[model samples]
Target: MDETASPVESADCRAISEVLSRVGDKWTMQVVVTLSDGPRRFNDLKRRVEGISQQMLTRTLKALERDGMVKRTVCATTPPQVEYDLTALGRSLAEPARRLAQWVRGHLGIIHANRRQYDSRR
Candidate 1:
C-alpha cells in the first residue's frame, strides 16, 4: 500500500486566505486600529483617521462589519446616532496592531532617511 498522501486543497486554507485578504487591505488595518480604542461615531472615525474620505470610511466600516470584526449600533436620538466598536475577535488583534504601530514608530526615522536618499538619487 502507498504510504504517502496526495497533496490537496483544503476548505480551511481557503477560508483563512479569504480572511487575510479582507484584513490585509490598506484601510482595513487602520480602521481596525482606530476602532480598537473604543466605540466611535462615524464622523469621529472619519476625523481621527487622516486622509480618509467619508465614502471610503463608510465602505471600510461596512466591509469590517461584513467580516464580523466590527459591530455597528444605532442609538435612539433626535437625528439617529450610529457608532462602531470592535467585536471580541477584533479586540484580540489590538496587541498585534499595537506591536506593528510601535515598530513603525521606531523605524520611521530609517524609512524617512531611506526615502530622502532614494529621492535625491532620482
Candidate 2:
C-alpha cells in the first residue's frame, strides 16, 4: 500500500489485481476467445485451444466457472456430456480480450524490437 493511498483505494486495487490475475493468465484470454464462438465440449475446446493439455484445460475451465465468467452444463445422456460456454460476464470480457489480442499482434514487431534492444543493452 502506498502511504498516500486511502484504505478504499487499496482495497479496490487488491480486488482489481485479483481479477486481473485470473483474466491475465496465459490460457484465460485464449479460452475466453474460443468460447466466444459458442458452447463447446471439453475435447473440442482442448483441440481448438492448441497446445493446451487436458489437465490445463480442465483447470482453466474450472477457474473460469468459479469466477462466474463461464457456464458449465452437463447433458443427461448415456455418458453425460459436459459443455462449457461463456456467461454474460464472460461475453462482456470477450470484446476487450479480442481488442487486447489485436493490439498485441499489431505491436509485436515493435515489442520484439524493444525486447531485442533491451536484451542487447543488458
Candidate 3:
C-alpha cells in the first residue's frame, strides 16, 4: 500500500476532521453564523438560515448539540419556547467562520469568473 499523507489522514488532526464533518456542512455553517450574534428561538433560526428544511435544521442542531458546539435551552412560558446558542467551544469557531465568510466574499467574483471560463470550454 502507498503511504502518501492526506491532510485529514493524520492521527493528531483527526478531531478536527470530525468537527468539520459537522461544521463543514452547509446548514450547520449557516446556523453557526446566525447564532454567533446571540441565541435564537427555533423558528427565528429557521428564518435566518434560508432554504433549510425543518428536518434538516433539527438534525443539524441535534448534531451540533451532540458535538458540544451548541447549547439548547427550553424557556418556561405560556406556550414554551426553545432556543439555541453557541457554547464556548462553538464561540471559538467564530473567528474562523468569519474568516471563511470573508474569504467567500473576497473570492466569489474570481470563483464565478473561473466557473464561467471553465463552462465556456465544456
- Highest-scoring model, TM-score: 2
What's model 1's overall lDDT? 0.87
Q: Model 2, range 1-122, lDDT digits (tens) per residue?
A: 68899999999999999999999998999999999999999999999999999999999999999999999999999999999999999999999999999999999999999999999998
Candidate 2 residue pairs in clash (backbone atoms < 3 Å): none
Q: Which digits, one per residue and each the tens of the lDDT, describe model 1 over residues 1-122?
A: 23353334455566778888887777888888998889999999998888999999999999888878899999999899999999998888766877888999999999999999999999
* Ten contiguous residues minimizing lDDT sum, candidate 2: 1-10
How does model 1 score by TM-score?
0.78
Clashes of each: 0, 0, 0
Candidate ranking under TM-score, highest first, comes to 2, 3, 1
Better TM-score candidate (1, 2) = 2
Error of 2 at 61 (Å): 0.7
Local distance difference test, per candidate? 0.87, 0.97, 0.89
The residue-by-residue lDDT of candidate 3 on 3-120, one tens digit each, is 6767556754677777777778999889988999999999999999999999999999999999898999999987998989999998888669889999999999999999999999
Give the candidate number with the greatest lDDT: 2
Q: Per-residue error at 31 for model 1, in Å?
A: 1.5
